[model samples]
Target: MGRFITVEPGINIFVEDINPAGRKTIFFIHGWPLNHNQFEYQYDVLPAMGYRCVSMDWRGYGNSDKPITGYGFDRLADDLRIVVGALQLKDFTLAGHSTGGAIAIRYMARHQGFGVNKLVLIDAAAPSSVDKQTANEFITATLNDRPNMLHNLTNMFFFQLITGPFANWFMQMGLQAAGYATAAIMATLRDENVYSELQKIVVPTLIVHGVHDKIVPFAKGQETSKLIKGSQLVPFQYSGHGPFWEERERFNQLLIQFVG
Candidate 1:
């Protein structure tokens, strides 16, 4: 069972156990508009393998307190710092997906003073990819008319595993939980430039991306891996955006091997 922990004044985070007393901790940060529940697959499987896994809901998502403030990378990094401090975690690995990957990179750049051992970025967005006029245009089109694009994006994530009734319910649940304000914050995410910051990250890092991911795209992952000094890029041939869900077993094995 998972428990709620208060990391900030109004933020209550959800944490699931995966070997509470294990030596090494794996702190998983979920993407935008989705909560810790997105990591349910990881939470259930990692613990039995003698690894401690922790996933927290960002402030406005999941069961966390939905404050209208503090939605940027710095603030999100602070939230994560508080959670780590409150838990007194050290020598841990950080794994993030999509927006969470951006946040994790920021956190490592800012807090390398603390002891973060390794990092894992799954289908992550690059810092300057938006600067390319074409990419920026695509982002603008998707954000401007998300409703029309949502179904296709959702389908791309699961490779059409979710469709019809199940897909509708899933999208509805995500929207209802995140709401418009969360979406607005996500829109502002493009402003962050992580390329400059990546040079400072000295931890051993792994970049995982699906070859067919339409959301962040595979090129971003390749570029990110190149930027992060000694980082390794792992490609998922048959998976799309949400490789963690589509290729759960392989993903978990890679995670264990990297963190081990």
Candidate 2:
């Protein structure tokens, strides 16, 4: 149910296509330092709920071509355009997590949500500026010690205390992400401002965030809800950065209700 779709001359995007014949499609964009596999859970659940689930790693992450350039949000948005065109996707609901969330916003702002009918953001890192002190510190830490920063980030994003096979699973996925993408993409992301785009989104939008999200604080979610005219915000009150994984059943139930 998955294959690589060529985005351009040399770029091939690896897409996980579930329920190939489902009437509606949901193109998923994963976060930084991770591939489309982050939505592995959704792949299993969404299709069964009568929706086609499609996800791809950004150009430089996962099994996609790791080109030397095109790591910025603008390029990321372009990549989505290429994928949708290649796949002939329509009336699709765009869902993005973390960095992917910001990319989805850019896709709307830059392209004006052409074929997309709805939007979903899961603990997105948006409305951030590169000039912010917090972002600058993160950039510094990522530059100075990438591995250490990733390790700390994993713990913070998942939960304060990670244990068992779940912890191992999460760590391995994070490790497999391209270091180049992780390092280079972060700076490009920090330079963007999605609040205006949020305000412009007229399609039904769902903003999902973990109340305990440390990477993209809960306040960011609240602000995003406020900015997006009719956007709805759902908080995973007892989870961290990844509510899809942390609260699978609840998240899926809510997502199904929203997308259906």
Candidate 3:
């Protein structure tokens, strides 16, 4: 159910479309330095509940084409626009995690939320959560020692105990991405501000953030919720940056209730 879609000339994004016959669709965009496969648990359960689960690996990550340039949020959002149009999606729920959530916000502002009816931001990196200094440190660390940076990031991803092997596997997802692209995206996270974009969102939004999240502080989610009128904020007390996996059951159930 996965295919390479040509979003632009010389660039093909890897898209995974599951349970195509389902009544409703939830399109997922993953966080930074990881691909669509990051939502493995959700993909396993949603399709069985009569929901079509669609996910795509943005360029320079996972199975997608890794180009040298075009890592800006504007261009990334544009890529999403094309893919949605190609799939003929309408009124689908758009779910984005971390950096993907920021890009999704940009898409809402830039494309006017073209095919999306609802928005879900999970541990999103927005509302000026990541400061410039920290982002610069990350970019420097990534350029200097990429493996160690990813290793440490994996350790900070979840509050629950994750096995050593599992941590390695998760870190590998970051390794799969291009080094320059990873840095470029981090730069976008550092330089770009999404507060105005968040205010422009008109669809019903669900903001799910881990109360103990180290990557994106819970206060940022609060700020994002305030900016987007009528957006609901849900805090996962036991999780860290990745509530979708750390608290998969509740996360999936919340998605079901909101998307329904």
Which tens-of-lDDT digit does each residue in 1-260 have in candidate 2?
Answer: 76888877888878778887997888889987788888878887888878899888888788787777788888889989888887888889999998899999999988889789999999988766334676666667777886677667677887545575766676666666566666678778666667677777889999999999878889899998888888899989878999988898899888888888
Candidate 2 local lDDT, residue 151? 69
Which lDDT value does model 1 have at 242? Answer: 78
Q: Candidate 3 regions off by >4 Å?
A: none
Estimate the overall C-alpha local distance difference test score of candidate 3: 0.92
Task: Please give each candidate's TM-score.
Answer: 0.87, 0.92, 0.98
| TM-score for candidate 3 | 0.98
Q: How many residue pairs clash in each candidate?
A: 0, 0, 0
Candidate 2 ranges beyond 4 A from true positions = 129-145
lDDT of each: 0.76, 0.82, 0.92
Cα lDDT for residue 95, candidate 3? 99
- Local accuracy of candidate 1 as per-residue lDDT tens digits, 1-260: 47777867656866665688876789898875577777778887888777888888787777777777777788888888888887778889999998888888889878772657888999876655334554454355455765554555576566535548856755553554445445545555656657888888898999999988877788889899888899999999878887887788899999999998
Pairs of residues clashing in candidate 2: none
On lDDT, the leading prediction is 3
Better of 1 and 3 by lDDT: 3
Candidate 3 per-residue lDDT, tens place, 1-260, comes to 99888988999999999998989999999998999989999989999999999999989999999999888889999999988988899999999999999989999999999999999999998887468898899899899999999988988888999998889879988999999888989998888878888889999999999999999989899999999999999999999999998999999999999999
